[model samples]
Target: MKFAALMRSAALVTAVALIPATTATMAQVDGRAGPEFAKLFAVFQRVKASYVEPVEDDVLIRGAIDGMLAALDPHSAYLDGGDLQRLETMIDGNYSGLGLSVVMEDGAVKVVSPFRGSPADNAGIKAGDFITHLDGTLIYGGSLDDAVAQMRGPSGTSIRLTIFRPGRDEPLEVEVTRGVIELEPVTHELGAGNIGVITVNEFSADVGADVFSAWQDIRKEAAGRVNGLVLDLRNNPGGSLDESVALADLFLTEGRIVSQRGRARGETILYDAETHYRGDMAEGVPVIVLINAGSASASEIVAGALQDHRRALVMGERSFGKGSVQSLLPLGPDAALKLTTARYFTPSGKSVQEGGIKPDIAVPQISDPDFALRQKYQTRESDLRGHLINEIGIKDEEMESDSIADPRFQLTADELKDQGVEDFQLHYAMETLRRTTASTVALRPAKR
Candidate 1:
């Protein structure tokens, strides 16, 4: 399963323009009081004569504007002329960079996650890595934009990163060459028992078509033997909202998938799954959705919709709460504004803002003990208050479960332990799929 990283912008303020009537009033007041203009002229003359450092007046004005804007939320930001142009190119998905997603935490830059099949991922960069130095220069207390600028360069150029990872005794050094990171929207494989596993990394521009192609490939490979489908959404930070809706519509035949409510009272839009792509073989197949802490935004949209409609059973930790929709507003030249326009809601009218989607079966991931000894796992089925939607009167069904001493999903205990498969989550998912498929098939009618 591939994980997609969601890139977020640091907070700043939106620019406000003075109205014409207010400008006229200010001009009238200034003209009536010649003393105020005289005072300004005297101060300017005094500053010009007595200033110690040579400073440009335009620089001071721009600095003041920047300072004012930075006080707003971390998402709003101000971009200089060069940065504005680069942002324009980034929005078009064409840029040369290290292809890493970063965030500001504790006044330092932190790696949230690396894009799948990108330079950073290939370089062995992992999530929760703290970047202390970029190209041998200390990046602490620096602006995120400046750090990003240092990371981005011409294609085929190499950049060195000094990172600090948890559970490591010493910091590690990785040198990655910049490249044109083409976003891969979807990837799939046939799991054990011919179970179709589709990993939607992100909802990119061509994701809808890519998902369709992936489903076709899975169907062809299964040859009518596919008993279950596992939609892996782990660490998938969402992208385009429309693509998410379209992807959800692929499996669902008819029902309210998701809904969005803007700031206004009655401003709401409901999305439904209308088109049916799956035939008899595809319908009624047991679906197991995998998610984690990094899964957010559009990923949550699909997860919440499926869970609410009882279409798929979610398995993993809670998702990242990012249920808001942002609209890109062009500010002139190469500048733009990504404003939070509305809050999204699941089909049950539950808002996921600051509250994430909880799985039907809460499985705690095992990331410790060196894989030698047996590790205990916890499954939470109680009603958790922080869940996006409330689980009402739903009883946990008795499903058969299994475990492998080894880590590989397809390998048995002895084989996996020898091969050293470290992905405990995938192993657990595979077992869950087997158990669910058996239970589903056992309940079905026996053919004559």
Candidate 2:
């Protein structure tokens, strides 16, 4: 099994999948738990001996393991043959399938987001689209793992998808051919006014280095000093913790990046800036970070760190709140225990478990015609079954409450489309940077 921390927030249904953590040794149970173990064994024996159908020992054992983990939190799970294989494939960063990230919402397979250039994205399988069938077979109320297995196949293969979009009148039938999903973790572009836009798709391996290289390339392309930067992390479910700290370190000169606190001795860790990189790479350049309901885990770490330090002006909807860390304990060569071992906090000692990282500026995605409908169905960490509760109590009503409306955002989707504004959030961020004098948005030198 991969001996790394799997910090990606949302559950992935595509070939790109969740990561695993460090190996852990099984601890001895206390004598006080003997009665509970005895009862479990009794139930196991009764099911095996008296059931009409003979139940396999492994099946029962697996079920018990799954139930135990599920009771704790949604992120914890038992990973065996197929699950471990998927983890390996995700780590490898390439596979053949309709690239998508999905989660099981009340037994229905709901699309989180399609990988940027994958077959699903190309075929218009958007986030919030409920996939009810695969190849005309009803998949509602089915296992997410089974549905994912059905969706993936050899490259060049095609599968029919029955999608139920939230505001659509009827279910749409679409056929998409599977292709190789090789996700580029970091992608950059030079927009107007020498503004460099760096989009971190995921916190995969060496993503910090990639972003540094991207900045260099953007500077070269501009042939002059870059005025501002937009770090786009919208729809980005996270990855490695190390990568997140590294990415945040690029723009921060000093101070704590994030701190992990857990019950275990070694689980509590403090990550700070200047440990990975020497100093701020974009020292005096202004930065604006973009996030939405889809940005989570490692993504939140970067956003929270930068926001707390006033390194960037975070704009967009509330993020997908996921502050816990999952450590993969190797049970065997083919299996491991993906357990939530710690809850992480931002530099200001804020936990983004239930409430998530609130943006410095709340900019709605009014570019989608179904924005209201999509927002209604959009799921976050708090929406998941058995999610970790925040240490500081955060009410559900408060988290669900809409941000105050701004008259500046009164433009309709149709109007924006006619005006050639493909992405409203990006447009707003770019426009804000463009209009601002460079000094106002420039990074303040670190105190320490």
Please, what is the TM-score per model? 0.70, 0.92
Regions more than 4 Å wrong, model 2: 1-27, 167-169, 399-403, 443-448
In candidate 2 the C-alpha lDDT for residue 426 amounts to 98
- Candidate 1 lDDT, 1-448, residue by residue in tens: 0011112211111111111123443346645668866875686667767889876786655555554444533334445464554433443556788777676655678776687878998888876678989989999888777888899889999999998876666889999999997656589998878888889876665666777788779888989677778888876767777777877776666677778766644336688777554422346677778887677778888888777767777887677666666554444334444555567888777766555687786655554332212121211212222222222323323121333332332344455556564555666676777776544422232221
Q: CA lDDT, every prediction?
A: 0.63, 0.83
Tens digit of lDDT per residue, candidate 2, span 1-448?
Answer: 3334222322231112233334433455688999999999999999999999999999999889878988998888777766666656765667899998777777899997898989999998888799999999999997888998999999999999999998778999999999998878889999989999999987777889999999999999998689899999999888788888888999887899999888876888898888445688877788999999989888999999998888888999899999988765556456666778889999999999988899888998999787988887777888788888898789878865765678998999999999999799999999989999756665464364
Q: List the residue pairs that clash in candidate 2.
A: none
Clashing pairs in 1: 10-74, 11-73, 11-74, 11-75, 12-76
- What is the model-wide C-alpha lDDT for candidate 2? 0.83
Error of 1 at 362 (Å): 2.5
Give the Å error, residue 365, model 1.
3.7
For model 2, what is the alpha-carbon lDDT of residue 209?
A: 94
